[model samples]
Target: MTQYEVTETSDVKGENCPMPVVKTKQTIDQLAEDDVLEVLATDSGSVSDIAGWADTTEGVELVDQEGDGDVYKHYVRKTE
Candidate 1:
């Protein structure tokens, strides 16, 4: 199992694009190695963006994802 912290959340209920991805990255960076981060976003694009970022990045792991309606949650584990 992975431990996660809700580092940041965006109420971008009506926002779109880059903002969601940008904010998610910002929060992911704040966590320590092996620590997981949970990001709350409202942008649909974040699903691909966040997953892509973790898959392509060398030191990040996209652990899981879940969403309810407009709110999307992403879990990322940092790797050193």
Candidate 2:
């Protein structure tokens, strides 16, 4: 696993599907350039959803992702 110094954390643990991606995008919007946001989600589909969102979204990077059974952690960085 890669190490990340998260600037903020967004908890959407109980959310599913588009909620995770939606919340992540919302949180990322609030972050400054180069800031990292750690998104905590319980939805298994978030792995792909978050990745795809980051890929298509400009100025945002999917830094890393970690999964431990029920919890999914996504690190997103804002780059201007």
Candidate 3:
């Protein structure tokens, strides 16, 4: 069986674009393979930024996503 763990979570509500992305990257770097990270951000751009980052970057997998009101939640898994 495969085990997934929540390694980190960031609530970047009211924050800007790069901040959320930057923080997400920092958290992802600390995670081991298959570890999950849930990031909450209010920036609308975060959806694309984080998704794009995961798709473009190596060793990162975007697992899930949810958005409501001004908050966007992104679940990412580290693969490398």
- Please give the CA lDDT of all the candidate structures: 0.75, 0.92, 0.87
Give lDDT tens digits, candidate 2, residues 1-80: 65568999999999988999999988898889999999999999999999999999999999999897899999999987
- Model 1, which residues run further than 4 Å from truth? 1-15
Q: Judged by TM-score relative to the true structure, which candidate is superior, 2 or 3?
A: 2
Q: What is the TM-score (0 to 1) of candidate 2?
A: 0.93
**Would you list the clashing residue pairs of candidate 1?**
none
TM-scores for all predictions: 0.77, 0.93, 0.88
Residue 3 in candidate 2 has what lDDT? 58
Which has the greatest TM-score?
2
**TM-score comparison, 1 vs 3, better candidate:** 3
Question: What TM-score quantifies how close candidate 1 is to the native fold?
Answer: 0.77
Once model 1 is optimally superposed onto the true structure by TM-score, how far is the C-alpha of residue 52 displaced, in angstroms? 1.0
Per-candidate count of clashing residue pairs (backbone under 3 Å): 0, 0, 0
**Candidate 1 lDDT tens digits, 1-80:** 55566544445455578776666677767767877777777788888988888888888888888898979888777787
| lDDT string, candidate 3, 1-80, tens digits | 33456778878788897898899999889878888999999998999999999999999988888798778999999888
Off by more than 4 A, model 3? 1-5
